[model samples]
Target: MPDTRQPVAARRTHCPYCALQCGTRISGTRADAVTVEPADFPVNRGRLCQKGWTAPGLLAAPDRLAAPLVRGRSGRLLTATWDSALQAAAEGLARVRDAHGADALAVFGGGGLTNEKAYLLGKFARLALGTSNIDYNGRFCMSSAAAAGNAAFGLDRGLPFPVTDLSRARTVLLAGANVAETMPPLMQHLHQARLVVVDPRRSATAHRAALHLQPAPGTDLALALGMLHVVITEGRLDTAYIGRRTTGFEALAGRAAGWWPERTEAVTGVPAADLRTAVDLLTQSGDCYVLTGRGVEQHRQGTATAAAFINLALALGLPGTPSGGYGCLTGQGNGQGGREHGQKSDQLPGYRSLSDPADRAHVARVWRVPVGRLPGPGLRAYELLDALGEEQGPRALLVMGSNPVVSAPHAARITARLAALDFLVVADFVPSDTARLADVVLPVTQWAEEEGTMTNLEGRVLRRRALLDPPPPVRSDLHVLHGIAVRLGEPPEHYPTEPRKVFEELAAASEGGRADYSGITYDRLDAGESLFWPCPATPDPHPGTPRLFLDRFAHPDGRARFADVEHDGPAEDTGAAYPVHATTGRVLTHYQSGAQTRRVPELAAVAPEAFVEVHPDTAARSGLADGDLARVVSARGGMTARVRLDPTLRPDTVFVPFHFSGDGRANLFTHPALDPLSGMPEFKVSAVRLEPLPE
Candidate 1:
């Protein structure tokens, strides 16, 4: 068993990496770096990943942004004073607003930002700039799961129950999530649990599973339907649960009617026998969960795939139960909270819809603005970025925390669109590729040097305490946005520089909304006691809802929903020209864009650069070998990456880590096709051909 200690040290904080948000302590601080020790936080039980241990290297990184940068008359970014930079930024944004109207001033945020920053960023876009064009990079993470969760459960918190509940489960049917590589700290929870993993590649997590169902890329929906088909044919489903707890069973049954085991095998390339075995493992256990991540959520039919999984879980009497259900493994550090607090295209402060009159009225009262003053739904992340420089699109962009050049699907085109922008400003702690392209770059404080709250994958809210002040001239993201808002004449009171105060206002705005955090405060979180949301502001605050749908879902009908979903396959079809299916993921040593992790000497030494993973059979066919330079090509673009042959991968598929930029960015060849409902780009499946680059 893990140490599982509660935080007893000074300056206890969460990791600055993925959504695991492991507890950490600032063990020591020096002029050059901050040392870290694992804290006994509940999530990880005092464990930290390599990236977390060396996260402080970024604080003292040689190239870390410390001053403002402006594109001077000579066409080069030159260091400038805060006043001059703010003046230039204000003048540029004002010019764009005057020429193209408010909608032209778009804001793009990141999932890594704290709840306070995310809330303020959205408020800044609508209340200050008064633009309807605002979204965040989180759209690329698992927005499909979010859409599916809302459609089925009427609410979308990454997990309906706390992650600790997984430890109590007898089985976990994990799909497409490489928890071993991406979130190793979470593996402890599954140490004693039987596992069933689904993926095209034998991912690290899949390799540890009792059963690994290797499906073809982008065919998760078909596989899910097949499992449901088995559960239906074998009488493993609970008809009573289906009738009482959920609706739309007949619709899903009608759709699953045609997806028999044989048909599913042909479509997904998973053996029919193996599929039945997977169903057996799931049905054999009273406590079992079905979870998914970006692999199954980054396709053109991502929402449909997610819905199919929910239908399967609900049919098996899993959801709304004690220790078994479906959940989405949220990616970015603050991906869960970031989406909850209004940075999403269609949401208000509490995951409330923009079109909902009551939601708008409540949030408007918090902002002290008219209900109608808030902008309506804007373009999703991909659409907003793709629409830049168009005739009727955004002319100026304000980016906070996100480094999209290396992270967006079809990043080459995104970079082109960004280049065409009349004006661009990026706020970051480092001078990333995206920041370098900005007309102005503002330096900001990093995670350890900031104070805020983050909601983890379990929907538990945890506090991030400030350890030390950033080097002089480095401001927090809240401060940067506040400065820009003040320059634009927005009142100072509305945009507080203090994180706790911003969170207080955010809580008020979130009152009565779906993801209510109105009752939670920094005071309640003082003793390392994290709270859940939907915590209504009562005299004695609710202990935050750790489990949802036990009594009722957020649906007006007081029941969970199931969708009649069909498999549409991948948006891009494989052909003779681009015969191989290419998929991308992250490496253990690097976070989303490698902006901070890449700067760390230890992490950089472990995984110095990007590489493509190919099966031995595919490598033989292409006359390629391990450690060889290869060019993966698609109609959109091509990227040259070093090849790492893995027998665990499917022969017709190749994998690349999407961390590095420039010549090695995997997003260069990814398809830009968006899911019809969610507008999430198909980053998981793409038609591509490969060739060896001569040594």
Candidate 2:
């Protein structure tokens, strides 16, 4: 009866979920329920996670906003035509700009957007709106690693090489990444390597590791320096590599000498014997990789921790090798590409700093604007939100593809400040919690219904093709942004209608810059050839690049710099009132903020509610039984959630997944203090206490 004999057309694309960017095939038409199947692409071969497999269900969700909506005078949201919606949004922004200058308005973006959208948003913020108060959700995700990598190596791609290369490695040191829960398929490759996982808790990945180094929450730098001390003092350092391929070795080694294992053990919970074993594994491996994640990057010493990781890698001659290097495991699908395309406040396209005159001139020319019009880097996310309710606060904001109320630090404060804004606009497929506060909400197309490109965790640029037509009245993000720019009197040539043309302009802006992408084109990507970035000016038609820096470094001296890092505690330390150290992270079942995944019935059925993970001892002490509601309280806020006693967690620590909101908003309790250099909030560690919720 349903035409079962008809062959469904196959639409090839990348998963819209995590940074894994596994290939997927959309089977069936928009009229019928579509099914997502794993494609046999090089990245994941044929593996699909629960999120990826059910990604298409989001398209048909009943709650999806199919038409633009405006908050009427009655304080109720009602459907409005596109023209009316755009006009209202433009007038509000223009009024704010006229009254308080452009700096009084702000724009926030996210890593989930395509490169075209990211570039246009940055362009609109700087050129159309004439504002320097532009930032993004990346301020919470990758700014720290980006800052450290730029300081040390002049580049910051998540993996500077392909993730599959890890299979060839003999030793893989996972400094703070929980690969088993975040990207489970990656464990298949890590299985062969001598795994070394470092974290305060014995995470799932750490439990499977050859060695687990449980350090105090903020003492990762100390343990890293201590390991480096052993390597240098015991003559295990690769002297030839140090002499020929790196600078600042003496300074780094001198800093390490003061961090002896015995001293480090006193600060960190890890013992000296375990530290020796971890270093020995690194020294003996034919090929080794040093990896860091948000655990190491979301702290006061974030940049220092990243630098220490790079120092250890350079000391071992890891960079520029196929399976050997220092990798920062990025969290978002477009985290790698987002930073390269000027989404960051301090950067331009191609990861060029705005302070550089040549970089400034290059971008100014690309955007056809005077260099003077392009203001310098703006405030980071946390700082921007903190400025929201002040007398000199940003009065208007444009939020694209992010739900910061749940994701940003200090949830209650951010929500209160955002409510005070004179105007707020949000462009998204769904009316997220943050969107609910918006004066204007624009309906944008979802990933499976849009055509663009995304760079994965490994820096592999791949095509994301549209499988279904957008619902009537909904439009692509590019279309919405372009309309707004045109309405604001931007030249027609400056605002292109097609996404491909915009991407080409973005690529041209990046040409000859640090993160060179001159070689990438829509034509090549459509031909099913994936390539790592810094793809040369001359095109290589054969599947782009699988690895980078095989022969050279991006630094001017052709060597990576090693930075000296010391021990520093978290922004908020555990104390008598808040004795437990609570960390926030993602669960395999839910993606960031539980936006689209939570809408899927099957996925929601499996993981229907949020829960706090506590050690059995902690549960017993707090009188919290398994599945009982427990109140997690901090100095700033508190929330009630079901409790699960996890054996893997340490007795002194607890874990909370940052996907739920409202009464269970984990970010409400997260400290707002940020790493000065990276601007990343301390999401991984905070001070809190737990109690059994009374019936």
Task: Give the number of the best model, judged by TM-score.
Answer: 1
lDDT of 1 at 220: 94
lDDT for residue 678 in candidate 2, whole number 0-100: 86
Model 1 clash pairs?
5-40
lDDT of 1 by residue, 1-695 (tens): 11123433468888888998998888445443467889887779878888888887876688878699999988899999988888888889989998889999999999989999999999999988999888999999979999999999999999889888888888888888999989998998888878999988888898799999988899999999999999998899889998898888987888888989999999999999998999889888688999999988998999999888889899998888885889999999899999988898899999889989989999999999888889999999999999998898899999998998998988888999999999999998788999989999998988877899998898888899877767678788888888888889899888999999999999998988889999898999886556887788998767889998987878999889989888988987899999999998877898898888889999999888778899998998988999999999999999998889899899989998898878888999999999988888999989998899986
* TM-score for each predicted model, relative to the true structure: 0.98, 0.97
User: Which residue runs of candidate 2 sit more than 4 Å off their true CA positions?
Assistant: 1-8, 539-546
The backbone clash count of each candidate, in order, is: 1, 1
Please give the range of 10 consecutive residues that has the lowest summed lDDT in model 2: 1-10
Give candidates' CA RMSD values in order: 3.4, 2.2
Off-target runs (Cα >4 Å) in candidate 1 are 1-9
